[model samples]
Target: MSFTLPTPTAAERNRLARLFAQIASDAGTRVMEVYESNFETRTKADYSPVSDADERAEEVILARLEQDLPGIPVLAEERASREGVGGQIWDAFILVDPVDGTKEFIQRKGDFTVNIALICGGYTVAGAVFAPARREMYLGGGAAEVFEGFLPGETVTQGQKLVTRAYPPEGLTAITSASHLDERTKAFLAARKIAGQTAIGSSLKFCWVAAGKADVYPRWGPTMEWDTAAGHAVLNAAGGVVTQPDGAPFVYGKGGEGFRNGPFIAWGREPV
Candidate 1:
């Protein structure tokens, strides 16, 4: 059966955002456990690396999602890699990337994250991203109700509300992917008057822009919905925008493309 739950109210969206943050924190703890251990890595059918941390953390996220928000479909990375999500359009669903930035996780770079997002009507309505090793958590929902917090235990506390900064007159500070920087991305940056750039793995690029740590993030390479949905939601709530190269709205639920994502640019604020 197709699951098409109605979008939650603004109050409910904020509540779900916090709930997602807690869930991401729980999954992140499991990821950290695997990170600290002697973990084994294997290559997926697509030749991308998958580690025990990915699977273990996904287990936590899936279990929690099932308990907290039952009946909603979940499109998770690990499970999707194993059992492909058939071509079924969904009006609403959850996207989970239990251990985003596996390369960073494998390299012990501490840039990996646990991501959970709620997508409704082809938009990311709520999301949470937790970087356990960095002790950071970000949540977004409602209109401009984005927050960043520290997770000391199972809860996220002392949340500092976040908003995207205005574009600086000097130039843009761009964030790029550490592992997937392609020529098209390089060419895109080369054309811009960039003041500085930082390369990081996973969804942190979107969070950096949302937090106003950077002005833009341009990815010309391939990504999956689970890779961008949560971060996109956080950025959107923080007064940022993510769109196509031509400035079109970036949308989700591309079941025809097998949930794969096209290149998109995320901006802290529109440049003049």
Candidate 2:
């Protein structure tokens, strides 16, 4: 079934979309500002790279969301591990990844983005992905928008309507993390004999699939809910599936345990 964002009226949907787009754009600005600056990169405890942009972008996104849509739970990457915030057992809430491609941003590749997803019940009702460095914004799936803006933060006029491509003949083209590829994914690929592959950073992996650029993404390495939530929502709206290997739906409220996601695959349709 096609997914849809929950909104009382077209006006309300448009209003929320505009606000979400702006918040994404602002977060993009904060990220780019740090991108332009000479910031030192540090390895996290797990050896994944992080920068000032990551923290700043989360701050910007969270601050605006709190002001703009208070009372709704916010499950942010940075705050997800904190004592009182990460365990989001909300009937409705926002899931955000402030700076999705920290590695690409650090490498100056400009493939990063600000990802936001709104969840209703246990599913992604709507999602927005803004790739600032590229000056493109992709929305819809459960909710429909494709837009390009002239300036870094100009108005996002709509573009082509996007949908996930049909599944591939020789199995799907899968995208994986640049830094976190692990044995489980390798084994899955080997056992499945999936040949085509691409490596990407941040939530753009999900955006790629949502935009019909790729068909699958399998992550076997460590990931928190925030790391996948926004992208998961985007994929979900785009006629895709993001599920635990056990065949259970990936639910939130995992608590402040930080890394929680095991291996999961996202695809245009359910993979055989």
Candidate 3:
């Protein structure tokens, strides 16, 4: 028999956001442990890099999720790599990327992050992202207002509410992937009057726009649902919108396509 999971209430969503932040932060600690050491890296079947940091961090997140939310299905990177996530349409589930920017982590660029997001009805309902090396954490969804915090130590410092900035009269500033910029993305930007552009690693591109540090992030390259979900949730909560190149909705849970994501543009505010 098939069962659909119910969406969390507003208060429950806020609690889950807090829980997810802590989970991501805890996993980030494991990630930092490997980052500080002489870590060994290996390539996955898909040719993407994976490291001890990724495995260790994923272990932390999986353990916590199993303890707290046992019934909900989890689609995590490391585990999914080992055992393919068979075709199943879930009404609600968790997406976890123990280390979102593995390349950055391997290169010691300090832009990698631990991501965890709750997806309900093919939409991100709550999420958390923790960049351990950068000492920053962001959380949003449901009743909880989008906010960012610093984690120089064990606990997160006070969180400051976040809101996407209005599109400036000046030309737009775009954030693109440092490692994955492609011809299509270049052409997309070329067609616009952009004031500046910044290339960085990981889902932080979405957070950049969410924090109003940049105006838009357009990606024509490939991505996984897990790679974008948490950042998408945070951006959505911050008054931003992520949609297709033509401004259609971008929904998740594409099991048939192996959970891959197509090109999408993230805007701080929809252009008038």
Candidate 4:
């Protein structure tokens, strides 16, 4: 697939931001409507959990993105394969995870999120994770200071900033999915001698590192590009490393190829 234009202008940027924010907020509304309800969930062929909330939220996202940014292509979770959109090595694309932490959402754990990322030149320039269940949004990139805005309330000022908690050395606090931590990730942590671990869901794992709430996140399980792009942008903006142990920077636009990342780490500071 051919790449789109370069970085968007201030006006265009704001438009995209607002569109994404609107979609995310709408998704929140859709999810919260059923957050406490008895929405049914079913197992995918791979045994992954999915609910109507996921499909509905993705529909809202796809509609808004297509209407607002017609030129830009969307890689939404539900539309990935149906659209025949994942094979090409495009220069730019919109990566979306309509409902991450589906298990958390299903269990009413309030850790689910809607993750969106702008991938260009094989890197995430703008990413946002809206935890609608918790009414918190982690938005970073496009400028300094990872902004954490509480929902239906205040907003982030253009100039004021937030940075990661200083990287810790006493013991690394790793974050994992409460219900989805796989055996490979567990073994990797155990063999690598990670000092401690905590469990949360969705892109919050990346936010944990960005906010200095935690130090590192190691995962060996299979993850689609949407799952990490937004979080990756936030962590990178906060002066953190989202790279392989071999020291190469994480690159996107690989689709189902390019190793899709294996046993990588998101560190708040230099590894010891």
Give the best candidate by lDDT.
1
Once fitted onto the true fold, the runs of candidate 1 whose alpha carbons sit more than 4 angstroms away are: 1-6, 143-149
lDDT sort, best first? 1, 3, 2, 4
* lDDT tens digits by residue: candidate 4, 1-272: 12236755434443444445556766767777777688899876557788888887888777877776677767777666344453577777889888888888887888888877788778787777778767676666644343345552234334234366664546677887666688777775776546677989888898888877788887766777888988887787676878765677778888667315455778887754
Question: What local distance difference test score does each model get?
Answer: 0.86, 0.71, 0.85, 0.71
Query: How do the residues 1-272 of candidate 2 rate in per-residue lDDT, one tens digit apiece?
Result: 11234443444544555567777877888887888889989876556677888788889888888898877778776565344453435667777878777778888987888887766666565567788887778665335566765344666655566678887776767788887788888887777646588987877788788877788788778776666766666676567788777777876545545326666888767775
TM-score of each: 0.94, 0.83, 0.93, 0.84
* Candidate 1 overall lDDT versus native: 0.86
The CA lDDT at 10 in model 3 is: 59
Tell me the TM-score of model 2.
0.83
In candidate 4, how many Å is residue 185 off? 4.3
Question: How do the residues 99-171 of candidate 1 rate in per-residue lDDT, one tens digit apiece?
Answer: 8899999999999989999999999988988888887788888744433446524765537788998887788
User: Backbone clashes in each candidate structure, one number apiece?
Assistant: 0, 3, 0, 0
Candidate 1 deviates by what RMSD? 2.5
Q: Which RMSD values do the candidates have, in order? A: 2.5, 3.9, 2.8, 3.7
lDDT of 1 at 6: 70
What TM-score should be assigned to candidate 4?
0.84
Q: For model 1, what is the error of residue 49's alpha carbon versus the real structure, in angstroms, after optimal superposition? A: 1.0
* Model 1 TM-score on a 0 to 1 scale: 0.94
| Residue 165, model 2, lDDT | 85
